[model samples]
Every structure is written in C-alpha cells, then in structure tokens.
Target: MQMSQIVTNFFDACVFFPRIIFFSGLLSLSGCSNAVEFVQIFTGNNGPTGPNLYHFENKEQLDLSWVKSAMSRSDYEKVLSRIDFKRQVLIAVSVGERDSVSENVQISRISLVPVADDTIVDVSVRVGMVSKECEKNLTSYVFVLGTFEKPKKTLSYGGFDMDNFNAGCIAELSGQPNGP
Candidate 1:
C-alpha cells in the first residue's frame, strides 16, 4: 500500500478516538516563554458545534470529513493546503454554543511550556459578547493551526479566556457594575 493509503487507514481507525488532556482551562507557565507562531485557518458562526480542541500530526490524519458537515469543500481544502504538516502541526479550537449570533471567539495567543515529560499548549482566546438577545443559539468558532517542535512528548491543550478588554458590552450584558 502507498503511504497515503496507510495513513488513511490509520486515521480511519482513529476518527472516533479522543485524546485525553492532563488539564485544561487556564494555565500559567513559568520558565522561558515563547509564543508559537500561528495563522487563523478559519473562523465563523457555524455548526459541528460544541467546545472542541483538536490537533493533527500530518495532512493525512487531518480530517476534512467535517467539510460537508459545516464548511465548504473548497474553503477547507484551501486551508489544508496552506499547512506544511512536515514542519508544523495543526490545532483547532472551538467556542461551542452561544445564545446569540452576536457572540464570537478569536484566538488571541498560542504558547508552549515544558512540564516534566509533557508539553502544554496554552491557547489564549478573546471572546466578544454583545448585549443582543436571540431566539436561537449559534456556534461560534475560531480554528487555529499551529504547534511546537518535538521530541514527541505528550501534548495537552488548554484555553485561557481573555475577556475582550472593552467592559461596556460585558457590563451591559451582565448587568454588573463592571465587567467580570
């Protein structure tokens, strides 16, 4: 079998596989700090919804099956082609569901930290929330694609919520004196 065929088979077997993280939410890392350079692959209010974090080691393992589920084939392919999987890994972060379309998420920063035998991928995300009330819910997502180098250590993903610095919308929405 060809390499692509083998990879396809391997990915097919693991499509339902879920990676376990040591911990998530906010992480504060000490020691040499370096920001992992990343580019936004795609961001929008769409389905395939729910809070999710995914990482792929190579192009063959990167599932585009979700293309038909929530995005266009052309757009997803374009993003896939941009990734040089040989040198970099792919990481995706989803914000799950929101009550209004006025809510959105943006990947603010990406960084890595060494802990014993593993590396923690700390993703800082900024959320935009408006005071609009909606009759239905929307899934807002920011798919990021990047990772650090390897000795092939166990990798964990965590998200740090950096509230949009503007307190006006937050305050108005929460009915609090100041934004939380």
Candidate 2:
C-alpha cells in the first residue's frame, strides 16, 4: 500500500470504535433521507426532474386523454416519450369546458419488470403518481403496460400531447436533462 493508505489503515485500526458510532448516527439520518425520498417517489415534487406527468392549463376546459393500448413497437415509442421528458407536451382527447385533467396525476416515477417467453414479452409497471394539484398526496399503481420488448432494448423519445393530460411509458434516464 502507498504511504497514505498505510496512514489510513493505522487510523482505521485506532479509531474503528469511534468511527462505528459516527457511522451509525449517520445511518439514522440516511433513513430519514430515504423516508423523504420515498414520499417524494410516490407523491412527486414540483420541478423538471424525476418522472414525467402531463400537466397543462385548463384552457376553456379541454379534455385530456390517456395513451392508447400498445400493440406494436411504435406504441412503445409513443408511450415512452411522454414519461421520459421533464416538461411533456399533451394532447386533448376529450372535448370539455375545463382542462383535460382537473387534477393531474404525475407518474412521478416508476419501475418495470417484464416476464416473457420466446415470442412475447409482458411487463408490469410499478407506477408512482403524485397529484399535480396536491403534491404531498401520492398514490402508487401497478399497471400492466400492455406488451413490449425485453429490458435490454435501448429506447429514446421526446414529447407528445393529447389534451392536457399526460400518460404513457418510461425509459431509464442517466442524470437529468435541462430544458432547451
């Protein structure tokens, strides 16, 4: 080991007891941090980060529609774009006097597991939704997101809209992106 490593080892041996107590204390703080994150994960926070939920103005009361069921690869691409971006575009499916969604449920985040044989892949999405109207009130749901590819497929999507409501699939993102 290098001289610095030797010094570190000496300290590690000498101060192991004290360090353990310190680390234990930090772990408690970590639990609190994780609790906050858990709340955030389900409820979502207001910003251009984390999962994407469709939000739009209630312009003369519009109709926000959910994405259609997927039947092919193109369907996956369409759904992926809505959930992948921070500020997503929305399309109005229902014609109404109010916004497509009076209260929007942002899928703050989600995790997916796919089970498939040789010819077909069926996936279950563990989706977390926070009301855009009330961010603290978070709800989680398990959506059978129709069918799609295996987890190994690399996908890319940007933005789409139908009414003011935003709903769709997701792709794992690295870090986060700032709007252009």
Candidate 3:
C-alpha cells in the first residue's frame, strides 16, 4: 500500500476508538439519573391551598393545625440523637391510604448525603388516598441548617388521625469555630 494510504487508515482507526468509548460511558451514567429526585414541601391548614403553604424557618410557626399533631417528642428526640449532624441526613416521607398501598410511593425514597463543605438533606412527603384524593397524596420536604426541635402540642383538634400523615425533616448543624 502507498505511504499516504497507510497514514490515512491509521488516523481513522484512532478517531473511531475514542468516539465509541465516550458514547458508551454516557449511556451508562444516564440510566442512574433517577438516583435522587426532588419533591415539594408544604405546611398549613389546607396543605398547599395557596401561597400560604410555603417553606417556614420555624416548625412551631407552621400552621400544623391542619395536621392532627406531630409525632411524639420522645420519638423525635431519639431519632435526632442517632443522626450525625456532621453528615447530611436523608429524610423520606411516604403517604398512603389508611389501608391501601398505592400512596406516596415516590417521596418514600427521600434521602440525605453530605457533600464537601455542605450538608445535604433529602425529604419526601406523600399524601395518601382520601376523600380529597388530589390533596391527600400531595408531598413536600425541606432541608435546613441545625438540628430540629422536638414537636410540641399547642392545641387540640379532636378526632384527627395525626399519625395518618407522614413528614420528615433533615438538617446539619454548622460546625463550631475552634477555640479562641
């Protein structure tokens, strides 16, 4: 074969090899895109009826009146103690019918992971099937800095099944500065 023809063939082979490898690598990573997903968080009497159901800095300030009552303080404290604020916390909330499984299946997988220089919190809330089907399965979540306070009861709304709904919050407290 002529020298020019041999050189041309060599260049073509080199270009084709890298292009094949690059495309296969991209395909593998694309399948893992759903590894983590985002879910909206809401709080108030009506559960995102309007702008009122936005994020809140203070949990107590939340109009949880719509919610029967939060989980017991002792239980919350126990969970908090087990968590490491130095690392990001993953919180998952899943809602389902009182007796059915076709509920907040998506939000149930919420999780938290600590990234360099920052703590990441993951939350998922699922509203289950109820008379208000659309509103029932709605889910939301929030991530904040610092540990959460135990929920305290401030009033009573008789007959509501507070436990029926599931909610989770995760946050990492900022590190303290070194000694002076």
Candidate 4:
C-alpha cells in the first residue's frame, strides 16, 4: 500500500477507536491533562449562542505537556516527563474576516480548575492578545474559548492531536512545505 494509504489506515484506526475519558459534566474530565486528541478548542462570542466565534483547523498543534503545565498540578508532571510550553501553541481555527477577531492574539496556555459549586472543571485560558480592534476602534466583544458537549453543556480537552512533532524536522529535511 502507498504511504498515504497506510497513514490513512492508521489514523482511521486510532481516530475512530473507542477510547473514552471519564467525565461528569463540563467541570470534570479525568485526562484533560494527559495526551487526549482534540481537533479544536471551543470558544464563542455571546455565549453558546453568539456572533463572534473560533473554528477548528488541522494545522494547529496542541502541546498538552506545555498546556498542562499551567494547570495547578505539579505532581502530574512528575508521573510523566513534561516540556516547557512557554509560547508554543499550534491550534488552527477557521476565523474568516474575523482575522482581527483573534489575530496576533493567541490564548496559548490553559488550565482546568474545579468549580466549588459542582464537580466540574472550569477552563482558564492565558491569552496573548495584540488586536487593532482592541486598540483603536475599541470594539467590545466577549471571546469564549474551550471545548464542550452541547447536550450536557460539558467542556473538555479531549479530541486533540498530542502526538510527537518536529520529527517534524523531517518535513524540512525532505524540502516539503513545513513552515508555521
């Protein structure tokens, strides 16, 4: 079989496989810190029913090891060797004309916290923003971030690609288009 065919089969097996994380609503997910494959982070404007929003893309990568460090759990890192995720957030979003919506502004780091009222994880994002809209026009819009299940209204860090990259460098070595 061709290399693409093999890759397709492998992804088909892993992507469609039934691997589940134990979650109890939006606040509680067992492996939000571990290597769960997430295709997108759900953030919206005007709550779940709003105008401004971000979409998911395949190019953007997730450094959970880096993303997880922002979490309040140091011991978790001890179990698995961790990497420093200073500003390396590779998440792709479908922001059409709203390029200015979250442009130059990247919510690179995130953490999961326990909500006192319920057994759920509250999502916190550490954003690095430099938007012209936020400067001159002073346009005001609420930017929502993170993933969730609508029926249960539960947010999660699952459904992402946490595989090793930079091997990645192979793309460069092969003279392939590998910038970004």
Ten-residue region with minimum lDDT total, candidate 3: 153-162
Highest lDDT scorer? 1
Give candidate 2 misplaced runs (Cα > 4 Å): 1-45, 49-103, 106-150, 165-180
lDDT (Cα, tens digit) per residue for candidate 3, span 1-180: 999999877654432211111231232211110113333232112111111111222334332432212323564454344444333221322121122222232334322222222222333333332333323332332111122221222111100011224322221111111110
Evaluate residue 32 in candidate 2 and report its C-alpha lDDT on the 0 to 100 scale: 8
Candidate achieving higher lDDT, 3 or 4: 4
Candidate RMSDs in order = 15.1, 18.7, 18.9, 19.2
Q: Which number leads on TM-score?
A: 1
Taking the candidates one at a time, how many backbone clashes does each contain?
0, 11, 8, 15
- Per residue, candidate 1 scores C-alpha lDDT tens digits across 67-159 of 223555686677777777777766766555444333345677766655556676666666566545432333343233445443256665444
lDDT of 2 at 119: 13
Please give the ranking of all candidate structures by TM-score, highest first, separated by commas. Answer: 1, 3, 4, 2
State how far residue 161 of model 3 sits from its true place (Å): 23
Query: Which regions of candidate 4 fall more than 4 Å away from where they truly are?
Result: 1-39, 42-118, 131-134, 148-180
Per-residue accuracy of model 2 over 7-110 as CA lDDT, tens digit each: 88775443222111122123211110000011111111111222233322222211222322212346435544434232222221111112112233332222
Evaluated at residue 120, the lDDT of candidate 1 is 62
lDDT of 4 by residue, 33-121 (tens): 31223223333222211222222211123322222222224533432232222312223221111222322223332233223232222
Candidate 3 or 2, higher TM-score: 3
Clash number for candidate 3: 8
